[model samples]
Target: MDVPYDLTSYVRVLKLASTPSWEEFSRVALIAGAGIVLVGLIGFVIFVLMSVVPGSTPA
Candidate 1:
């Protein structure tokens, strides 16, 4: 499909992806990714614990 855009919209798109520094971007991305993985692991552990409890049924 053909897309349409105005000049201001094009500038906003460019600014969004333009990281001022590589080091800062890498640091932020790594910290954010680690946080996501940590949360996932904690959730999985809780799920497993819940499933193993006496009255719970396994899926």
Candidate 2:
């Protein structure tokens, strides 16, 4: 019996195997995500503080 080959699946598997390991990618991704969250939190705190102060114009 002859087996059928799926070229698309083979290509996808090869591409995934050639990609970077999860550990390396996850580390960079986590750092970037954390940085974004930290910046957002800081900006929110500043915004709240400014809003609570009297006579401050909203930007």
Candidate 3:
């Protein structure tokens, strides 16, 4: 309900933002990439199992 209060809070948040070092950026990127690959592999396994199993879905 308070516009000024919200604006000040937003400013405070912006003030805390900073650029990540190359090492830190690379570490985060590697972890994110690994998570994405892991999720994709799990989804692929589920899809393959569903297609190969009998009566898994209505034909």
Pick by TM-score: which candidate is best? 3
C-alpha lDDT values of all predictions: 0.85, 0.86, 0.97
Q: What TM-score would candidate 2 get against the native?
A: 0.62
Error of 3 at 43 (Å): 0.6
What residue pairs are clashing in model 1? none
TM-score computed on alpha carbons, candidate 1? 0.61
Candidate 3 TM-score over all chains jointly: 0.86
Put down candidate 1 lDDT per residue, 38-58, tens digits, no spaces. Answer: 999999999999888977865
Model 2: weakest 10-residue lDDT segment is 1-10
Summarize candidate 2's per-residue lDDT along 1-59 as a digit string, tens digits. 32345777777788888677999999999999999999999999999988999878656
Listed per model in order, the count of residue pairs whose N, CA or C atoms clash below 3 Å is 0, 0, 0
The residue-by-residue lDDT of candidate 3 on 1-59, one tens digit each, is: 99999999999999999999999999999999999999999999999999999999787
Q: Highest lDDT: give the candidate number.
A: 3
51 Cα displacement, candidate 3 (Å): 1.5
Which of candidates 2 and 3 is the stronger one according to lDDT? 3
Instruction: Write down the RMSD of candidate 3 (Cα, Å).
Output: 1.1
